[model samples]
Target chain A: MTINEIQDQIIEEFAQFGDWMERYEYLIDLGRSLGPFDERHKTPEYLIEGCQSKVWLYPSFEEGIITFTADSDALITRGIVALLVRVFSGRTPAEIVDARIYFIEKIGLRENLSPTRSNGLLAMMKQMRLYALAYKTKQEHS
Target chain B: MKLAKSIEEIRSDFPILSTKAYGKPLVYLDNGATTQKPLQVIKLLEELYRTTNANVHRGVHYLSDMVSERYEAARETVRAFINAGAREEIIFTAGTTASINAVAFSFGERYVREGDEIVISGMEHHANIVPWQMLCERKKAKLKVIPFSDAGVLDLEAYRSLLSERTRIVAVTHVSNVLGTINPVKEIVAEAHRHGIPVLIDGAQGIQHGMVDVTDFDCDFYVFSGHKVYGPNGIGVLYGKAEVLNELPPYQGGGDMVANVTFEKTTYNVLPFKFEAGTTNFTGAIGLAAALDYISLLGREAVTEREQALLARATTGLSAIEGLRIYGTAPQKVSLISFLPGAIHQYDAGMILDKMGIAVRTGTHCAQPLMGRYGITGNIRASIAFYNTEDEVDALVKGVRKVTEMFA
Candidate 1:
């Protein structure tokens, strides 16, 4: 699926929640159910330091498509990362780089996505895009 | 149990208390970061900007004279609030961080030499830690730390050993911003004085909790921010000993800091003016006076008692939560609690609480060394003021329990 389609799907899923508590509970569940990340990828190279939480994002490009995996200490942050990974992963570097993410706002998680929130979501988003841009540059060079 | 005024009256004074957050009544417990200003302080700031808007100390006009008089009077007000010797000792700066930097630069230039030592406590905020660290780096001096226990009590024995003839100065917090430990600052001051070392007490957390008599403590410097003490932001006090401050050179060379400036040489101003270089925060200073007056009318002793009760109530309520670990279990503490609910991340807990219209601080609280000591990234801090009530404490406790259950 395209990034926007997946984002719309996620928004639709979140719209089912009755309240902030329910939304958070679903997020926590998502966090708990995240696929096991490679332990070796958890290093300073992949670390994104947020004032409130720590996030680690690792990306791999293969056959013109990029896959992303990330983790955070905070459950809610982990859930948010899970959402980003879902939307951006399994897409071409060009597609990932050019995609505009509006799911966070639609899901009423805009507060958490603020740069000043320092939960690493905004930083993670920027880092993800940077990774895609680098890979795209490398692809162009080849 | 008698208060100067009822909690209802005190809450009414702060207009923000009635405000809502996320459709819920705002339960603000971030007083350690900064207190909500009373209507008097807010109104005074507005009035100053409206009518008394003029540059202090230099203007020859009527507005300037009026503002200058009020600004000087504010200095007197601050001097009396901390029970300092005279108004000359009280120098206003941007805030606590700026005040500490001024001391670090000026004091380090005069007293510190190569291979000297400066002492600070482990739990000091970055404001207290970084300035001294910079001073130490510049002078090629060593920075010694006084460690605290698991209970967050400062080890004075270690502090005593840390001081020596090579020790240029000792800087410590009167109260730990994160730990809420009210260190025995009087004893700390005495110990530093025994070795002829001047002490600077970071009173950012201390001055708001209770009465701070600088002469009684006999510390060479007492620094605090106006915003933290229910006053306006962008203004802070650096209360130095008149004799000690007289010896140190000015931190900055600007308009007000010098008596006369020539292309050849510049003669510096005396005492407080020497430290205050540029156009000072006169409006903030006046607003701070209003805040101090508000506190005075409320009565310091009364505020202390009321806060103590709130702290007790909060401590009791928070202690009951399963698997919640409260850091800084000091016997002597102010109305603040830093804790982690079970294994939950502080950010997650804080975010959830914030959604419930409860404001709290969830980070290192600018005490990374202390966080290092605790072996954690950060924790959630709910710091209370007198305006906070048992209902608010109960709400926090309920919120924590809810967070814990959901995480489970």
Candidate 2:
């Protein structure tokens, strides 16, 4: 979905809920439906630093496109990572590298994430972008 | 036990107890944030300003002398409250954060060297964590953290292993604000001192729950906020061993900390003044003294018993709820509980409770490392003070049940 469409859908879905609890449940369910991740891919290398929950993200480069699969021990944190993945995953290396997805500010996620989790999100984004940058460099060299 | 005074009489002392919030009686559970002051403390502040509103220890006038006497008397009160060896050892600051940072800046600057390690526990508040991290970064020192067990108690074995020849300092909280786990500080101090390493106990949460005798604990430094102990804001105490205070360099330079000033060289003042540095919070110090008087009248033992009873009731009530998980199951804890419902976010739960006129703290409570250790982003924290009642606990339980029913 386009960025605007995704934003509109998320807002509409959130508006249907009465309170934060319902919204939170809906968000977790949305995370669960973002396709299955390969269990074999979970490792120390994919770990996101500073998160309260244990979150793992693994990225793959296939034909210049970057695809990532992520999981978290906590349901809400998993939902947060899922949201992030939906925004950046399956895009070209250049697109992923250049995209300034303001997901945190747009969704008001920072207020929800603890200071540590917020730092973890930043760390995860940094790592993901680094992976894309490496792929772009390799493509240029080849 | 015969009652010296009833809760009704004691309740009258606090003006905020009668105030309403959101069209309901204010049920404040955010005592951990900052406590509401009693009439005694407020009266003390008012009297200080009304009768003797003068800068202390400098002027020759009667008001200045009275102000100085009151201010110094407050220092003595703090010294007795913490059972410090000497009144001169008590240096006032802008609260626990300032007190911890003073230790970090002075002791951490002078002693910590490259390749040396500073040990801290996983349950420390950010006030205790960030200062040490910054110190380590600046001095090229290594930071070692003592892990916590699943029960929220500090892993004593891991702590022993983390301590070695390179260890210069060990700073830990006397009580975990988030987990409500009262640490074995006396044991930790003894262990650290065996290797001649100095330990600073962050007593911001400790001073409220029970009595703290620095001599008994044998800690090099102990710090607490006045506001946490029913005192005024902008005031806290840092009690260091006389020898330790003498050894450390001055943290800040200003009016009171100076002995002599010259173009070429400047000499600093003696013991507490050398560290105090500024005009200081004169009124806050007086209010703090009044707060100490109030607590003493109630008696520490009485306050502790009352708080423990309230905690027991709260925990029992909260545990009865289905699918409710209470964090910090340590054998030793203060009157605080952090919990999460089976399928509800902590924030959502907190919002629901808030609507019912019961206030609670949600999120990490500034102990991010501890939260990470527990594998939860956050939890709802209900911290009880001595003034809290059984009826409040009942209300809290009912509120939590409502949230659970709504979510379920």
Candidate 3:
């Protein structure tokens, strides 16, 4: 599915919840179900900066596609990472670089993306885009 | 003063206490970040801007003269509030950060030298830490840290040992913003003074919680922000001994800070005016004085008593929760509580609590070194004011229980 399609699906899923508690519960569940992150990739080199909570995001480029694995100490932020990774991973560099994200606002998680919030979801998104851009640039050069 | 108002009446004074978040009544426990302003302060600000708006100490107009008098009166109010020796000692700056920066730069220029040492405690907020570090880097001085124990008590023995003949100045916080530990500032001051070294007490967290007398403490410098003490923002007080302040160079050079100015040379103004550069925050100073007046009417002792009760209740209730661990168990603490709810992440708990109409501060609370000591990145802090009630404390405890259950 396209990025917009996935975002629409997320918004629809969030719309089923009546209150913030219910929505956050779903996110927490999603956070708990994320794939295991490698311990070696938990170093400072893979750590996303500017977050009050620690988030380590590791990206790998292979066969013209880039895959991302991430983890956060905070469950809500981890849930956010889980969502982003699900949407962006297993996609080519060009797709990720060109993807437009609009679900966070629709799902009422726009605060996590605010510059004032120390959750670093915004930073994580930016880092993901930067990685995709770098891969795209390198591929074109080669 | 008048008989202290009941908590209900006092809560009424602050309009924000009535505010709701996410369709629930707000439980504001983030007083450490900044206290909510009372109608007394808010109305005073509005009244000043509406009727008495003027540039102080510069114009010959009626408004300017009136405002200048009120501004100086505000300084007198601050002096009386902190019980400083003289009104000339209160230098108004932007906030506590600015006040500390002013001292660091001016004091560094005047006193700090190559290979000199500046001692600070581990529990200091970033506002107190970074300024000295900048000063050290500029002067090639060394920054010495006094370590604290698991209970968040500063080791005065270590502090005494750290102070040497080459120690330039000792700076420490009167209260830890994150840990809520009230340091023994009087003894700390005496210890530094015994070594003939001056001490700078960061009173940003201390001033609001209890009475602070610079004369009684005998500290050379004490600093605080207005907004944290139920006053206006953009205004803070740096109370310095006249003898010590006079020896230091001015931090900034601008309009009101000079006695005489020429292209060739300019002499600085006297005492407080020498430190206050450019057009001062006259309006904010006036509002801060009004806030002080409001607190006086409420009665400081009563406020402290009520807040202590809230703190005790919170501690007891939160301690009862299984798997919950509270940090900063120093016997002497203020109303604030920082904790980790079992294996639940602080951000996760804070987010859940925020959605439940509880406003808590989550993160390092700008005391990274203290966090490092505890071996945790951050925790959830719920700092209370006198306006906060037992019901709010109960709500917070209940909220944390819910967070742990949800995560479980």
Local distance difference test values of all predictions, in order: 0.93, 0.85, 0.92
> On residues B19-45, what C-alpha lDDT tens digit does candidate 3 reach at each position?
999889999999999999999999888
Query: Which 10 consecutive positions of candidate 2 chain B have the poorest summed lDDT?
Result: B1-10
Q: Candidate 2 on B22-74: residue-level lDDT in tens?
A: 58787888888888898999988888888989997889999999999999999
lDDT of 1: 0.93
> In model 2, where do residues sit more than 4 Å from their true spots?
A1-142, B1-3
TM-score per prediction, in order, is 0.99, 0.78, 0.98
Which structure among the candidates has the greatest TM-score? 1
Interface RMSD of 1: 0.5
Would you list the clashing residue pairs of candidate 2?
A: none
Candidate 1 chain B lowest-lDDT run of ten: B1-10
What residue runs in model 1 are displaced by over 4 Å at the alpha carbon?
none
**DockQ of each model vs. true complex:** 0.95, 0.08, 0.81
In terms of lDDT, which candidate is strongest? Answer: 1
* lDDT-better candidate, 2 vs 3: 3
In order, the candidates keep a fraction of the true contacts of 1.00, 0.00, 0.80
Per-residue alpha-carbon lDDT of candidate 2 for residues A25-140, written as tens digits (9 for 90 to 100): 66667656766878887778888755344668899999888898887655566677777787778877787777766545655555545554343556777788999999999999
State which candidate, 1 or 2, has the greater TM-score.
Answer: 1
Ranking of all candidate structures by their lDDT, best first: 1, 3, 2
